[model samples]
Target chain A: MAEIVSLADAVAELVRDGDVVALEGFTHLIPVAAGHEIIRQRRRDLTLVRMTPDIVYDQLIGAGCARKLIFSWGGNPGVGSLHRFRDAVQNGWPEPLEIEEHSHAGMANRYVAGASGLPFAVLRGYTGTDLASVTSTIKQITCPFTGERLAAVPAINADVSIIHAQRADRAGNVQLWGLVGVQKEAVLAAKRSLVTVEEVVDELEPVDGGIVLPSWAVTRVAEVPGGAHPSYAQGYSERDNGYYAEWDPISRDRAEFEKWLERTRTTGVPA
Target chain B: MSTATTELTYTSDEMMSIAAARALSAGQRCFVGIGLPSTAANVARRSHAPDLVLIYESGALGAKPDRLPASIGDGILAETADAVVSVPEVFNYWLQPGRIDVGFLGAAQLDKFGNINTTVIGDDYANPVVRLPGAGGAPEIAASCHEVYVIVRQSKRSFVDRVDFVTSFGHGRGNGDRARLGLPGAGPTLVITDLGVYRPDEHTSELTLTALHPGVTVEQVREATGWQLRVADELARTPAPTSDELAVLRALKEAS
Candidate 1:
């Protein structure tokens, strides 16, 4: 059975130091609130996993919560670069962060493998690129039936997975729509999962092309309205495009990023 | 149609987008990266290829964004998409299976063989002078899409003899390379640039200038490229953007 808990309580209970944590949302429903809570609680040495690793992951890495990042791509979306991520990689500011990179196909398959309880997943990716050279997890295997060579990557099971959704029922069956990434897979693959939603209702109408995680599958549910702000929650709010444009300059300089971090730490989640 | 001599003023970037958009026929499923590729794909959908399906890396299938998507995962893409699936489904089911007809890409650096580098600028990957966003879905899209069309601004720095790092394989080493590696799909069929358009030489796998953009000189293209570029025996000047093409392209840009 899933329990309805506060965001802080959920993060404190589930996330720990040196734990592998996945906070997923493609472009929508990013769990920025939970990430902030983890930062506020000062969790360290976390191996953060996400497909894109946009502003939220940049925030987590900038706050020194991450010891390593496992991702396919890291950037500020429409903006230029993730300065803190670049700093961590190029200059080693705050701390030296390690990276395990994969293509989107490879990362997605890894999560699929995890959700399926498989040791690894095979696909026709990374055949002619340099990623296989740097990423040791990607191995070459031959198909038993056809003798065709394929790329295989191990499953990624995390200690805890966190995500934000549009809504959930009191019984903890979470429902989300619009650009669902690996949240379902990430949640199922983790030993424990915390989902933050805009509101808890009595019932959830069936969402077309949406995923519903039954109560038994989820560990905890937290009501954090506007949790995926900066990122957006479809039908609930519009994406604050202004914030993304504003973040580019704020995150560029080390002093500005530190100053912004200080305000974020004290101010709590934005409304 | 306006006479060819009557000048139509548009930026080279706009011209590149128009050229890239024109390559897609109706009802082609295009796997698009953000930036120029997204712009080109959207333009095509609005202007010529109304049925063109735009599949983004965010797992939004047949996305029809009224405005330009900021990134592959932009909210507008999902909000207006025909259907959305999980990230794994996007790669494994849609992209890896070669369902996409045209894979549209943008590159930081491109080589003679059409191999691209979006990873790093410097030779040493460890200590790169400039670290680019690593491959998102480019490797698979480049491998499995039926054909590919690259949109990039040509310059000495970007259009190089060899990329610092190979992020997406075009023709690999040469003619039989992609097949030898058992990789599927025909690698980059067209590379659209501000200077002109390039098609891979069937035998050598080297990109040759098949058409030059109107007003762009062969000398200018040569000067911009790092290597001695190969020009087609009879290079055709790409037709100027039609009035409708320009109007649709401009409106799309303004809406975004």
Candidate 2:
């Protein structure tokens, strides 16, 4: 059964040093508050995983919390390059960071395989690309039925998976709508899961195109309103595009990023 | 061709976007990347290709946003979509099965053969000069979509003879490369840039400059390209963007 807890408690209880953690949200509902909490707690050596490692991951990476990153794309969405991520990879400013990259299809399928309790997943990807050369996780396999050659990727079973949702019932049944990207799979694929919701409701009135994660599937739920700030929860608020654009300059310089980090550290729950 | 009659003033970027939009036909299912590709796809839908289906990797299918989306998973995409699916389903069931008609992409760097490198700029992978966002859906989008179209600014920096890394394979060494690699899609049939338009040579599989955008000269295109570019025997001038296209494109930008 899922436990209703505070964001700090959830991070302390679920995330640990050197753990493979996934905070999965595509371009919407990113668990920014939870990422902030993890940073505030000073957790280190985490293998952070996500499809698109946007500003949240950039913050975590810049704060020197991550030891490795497994992701497809790492950018500031509409704005530009993720300066902190670029710094880590190019110069190793905070610390020497390692990266294991994959295409979106491969990463998504890896989560699917992990959720399905499978060893690997197959797809028609990376055939002529150099991604196969760089990443060892991508391999070639022959189909048993058709004798066709295909690419195979190992399942990504994270130690802990975190996500932000629109709402959750008191019993901790989480519901998310609008661009529900890989949150369900990421939760199911992890040994433990944490969901930060905009509110804890008496009941989740069925939302159109909403995905519900049953209490039993999820480990914990924390009510942190506006948890996905900067990145938004569909019905709750709008994506702060200006903030994303503003982040470029702050993150560009090392001293400015450090100051922002300090401010984030000093701030409370909804950092 | 005479440039006497057209009086409207527009940036080369606008012309590039309009030309890229013109490539899409109505009813085509286009897998769109964010930024330049997304802008072009939305422009096409609003103008010439009304029924064009816009698919975002964030799992919004047939997304019809009134304003341009800042990101692939913008709430507008979901709210306006015909159906929203999980990320896995978007790639596995929709894209991997060859259901999408076209894949529109943007590149940080591209080679003469259309190979893309969105990974890194420097020679060393461990220590790169500039670290770019790695491949999102471009590899499979390049492989599985019935055809691929690339939109990137033409420059010596972006248009290289050889990409630092092949983030998405276009044509490896030229003819029969994709076939030999078991890639299914017809990779990068058209490439639109600020300078002009390029189409792959049927026999050589090398991208050849097929048309120039308005007043852009062939010499200018050559200078912008990193490689010794090839030109079509009967190189044509791309028709200037119509008033309707400009109105729609400007409206989209203004709304965004």
Candidate 3:
């Protein structure tokens, strides 16, 4: 049944230092807000994994909370002429497990490979390039007959995932109106999942036909009406853009981050 | 009309307006959003100023992406890109520090005083009508990028008198205190529309029409904007595209 626990308690209990936490959300939908609450409570050497490096990853990394990261893009495209996460490495931030953008598809396949306990996943798509590096990280093996190179990424078993959403039932059935696939992927890839909902309904509207994961995937549902702060949800509220666009310059300087820490932490709306 | 430049045989879209290209160049380092700015800046990179360090916010530095990335998440930007980064580092470290020379963005609307709101079309924020992709990193991109380059097709509705919501960042501070607030790169620099390029004056930072495309007229640009428009004194003609420039751009687009 749905319960009202302090987000602080819910997330703090699950996230550990150095854990590879996969934060769900696209450009700005269905972010791990409660988990971010855990972020504010204490700073630890954490590893955050997401598709492309954006504000959330940048904020955690810049704040010194994240020691390593896994993501794609990390800078404004043109205005600044930089890919931020890349700059972090050249500028002395810890080097992360860099993956290609298509690595998601490969990682997803690895999950199936792991669940099935298959020895390796095959590489058929792009043939060869730096992307072949995945073969190194994953156990690369060759087909004795075909003699083709294969990429075998290890199945990721996350400790737990803190997910926020628009609605969930007492039984823990969840419904996310937009951008639902990867959220399911992250949840399925993790051992446990902590959910935060905007509303707790008796049940939910019929699945949007195309929806994938069902209630069985959810572990616990925590109701936080405005959990997706700083970040934006699909139809609920728009992203606080004014805040995000201004991050580049501030994150670049350590001193500025100290000042930002004062500002955000002082007014830190207890996630 | 028929005699002079028709030999070029370029569509209005093919050759970028000079003002539009230059507006994109103002940024020493650009966190390219995608689409037009990506095209124009890459074109700018090949032709005039080779120094423009092109950063695909997707973490590709000077990545001559093969084609228009389907989205920021496309593999082209990631593969051809110089480096990969965590999503957070893009915002926390690179942009906020004022290192971003300019933010190249595409917007839904730009009100007078150069305020851009990419969130919604209707009035209500709670639950009234259409919901756009909530600001992913646009706001931070807008707020923090030292300057911004806006590439929007010309339209009266798009150049609105006011925005429903300020979904991304731009120089227009909430209470008109961007400069006063000590915000670095707190405002927009050039606006590149389908018809022409525009910039703000030295003091007011108001959007002023600067130069028109080859065939475009001042009235055509005026008709597209909702606000009262101003023109720059030295409206220059856009540069002609060389065969080499076209070939490189074509190659970049094809690799994706």
Name the top lDDT candidate. Answer: 2
Error of 1 at B63 (Å): 2.1
Worst 10 residues of 2 chain A by lDDT: A262-271
Every model's DockQ, to 2 decimals? 0.80, 0.90, 0.02
Q: CA lDDT of B111 in candidate 2?
A: 95
Candidate order (TM-score): 2, 1, 3
Task: Give me the displacement of residue B244 in model 3, in angstroms.
Answer: 25
**Candidate with better DockQ, 1 vs 3:** 1
Selected candidate, larger lDDT, 1 vs 3: 1
Which stretches of model 3 miss by more than 4 angstroms?
Answer: A1-4, A30-32, A76-88, A93-104, A111-120, A131-135, A143-148, A207-215, A229-231, B1-33, B37-256
Candidate with top DockQ is 2
Candidate 1 regions with alpha-carbon error over 4 angstroms? A269-271, B1-6
Provide chain B's TM-score, model 3: 0.84
Superposing all C-alpha atoms, what RMSD in Å does each candidate have to the true structure? 1.4, 1.5, 18.7
